[model samples]
Target: MSLKCGIVGLPNVGKSTLFNALTKAGIAAENYPFCTIEPNVGIVEVPDPRLADLSKIVNPQRILSATTEFVDIAGLVAGASKGEGLGNQF
Candidate 1:
């Protein structure tokens, strides 16, 4: 199974920026709050030289690198549990 990662934090705290950098998805990182209401899902290739070497030795038809899923969710505020900042629905 693939691994999933969720990015959660307060508004305008660079969470989007980090996600954009990691996934290169060109997601907008606005300066204001609540800019990212919907979640941004992306896959990142995991770099492992050992895997490449093993593939070379085994001579597989194709080399598929492992991947991880990154989910950039909306920001959370103080009252997120109580529906603040749109709550857990994000």
Candidate 2:
């Protein structure tokens, strides 16, 4: 099975930074528009102290916390709706 997530916003709104934080992966973050032409995506294990504590107490063979995916896609402009930039992606 597979899961997916996405990050989108106006250019330079910290979308890429947040994406990096979420997935703990490095993606090039550049200024100005159209910096990201293709999307950047990553999957990572979630770090949770509570889940670790529960595992210690319950002694379950398996422990699971929520995992999240991150994707950095190109931003858009108002003309996006009219087919400009990565607007079609939006």
Candidate 3:
């Protein structure tokens, strides 16, 4: 199963920075608020020794690692739940 995660917080709260560090996508993180209007998605493979052991035991042609998806959305502001900022849209 694939796991999904989201990085959300107030404007300019290092959400993109955290996503960049996690996925290394480097999708332009700036100091200004709302730098990321649209949500940025990145997938990272999870490394597990159990998977390798299973691969060796099953001897499959190819072994695929599990993945986790990270989404970096626009910063949320007060009243975001009320559709104040772009966070609601994300």
Candidate 4:
């Protein structure tokens, strides 16, 4: 099974920085609010000790490791319900 994780927080709160470090997606992480208008998504394989041990014993042609999806969503702002500060767009 796969898992998905989203990084969300206030504007310029290092959300994109953290996402970039995790996924290495190289998205435009500017130093301003709403820089990440579009959500950045990336999938990375999860390292499993069990998989490695199994590979040694079974010697399969290929091993499919589990994966996790990380999404960097735009920052959330106050008054979103009132459609303020581009919050509604996000």
> TM-scores of all models?
0.90, 0.72, 0.89, 0.85
Candidate 4 C-alpha lDDT tens digits along 1-47: 89999998889999889988988888888899889888889998888
lDDT of each: 0.91, 0.76, 0.91, 0.87
**In terms of TM-score, which candidate is stronger, 3 or 4?**
3
Q: Which stretches of candidate 2 lie over 4 Å from their true place?
A: 1-5
Model 2, 1-90: lDDT tens digits are 235788877777777788877776777777777778788878777667898778888999887667667778888667888887667574
lDDT by residue (35-71, candidate 1, tens digit) is 9999999999988889878987899988788899999
Candidate 4 regions exceeding 4 Å error are 59-61, 88-90
Candidate 2: pairs in clash: none
Q: Per-residue lDDT for 1-90 in model 3, tens only? A: 799999988888899999999999999899998899999999999999898788888999988889999999889899888887763897
What lDDT does model 4 reach? 0.87
Task: Point out the higher-scoring one by lDDT: 2 or 4.
Answer: 4
Where is model 1 poorest over a 10-residue stretch in terms of lDDT? 81-90
TM-score of 2: 0.72
Alpha carbon RMSD to native, model 3: 1.4
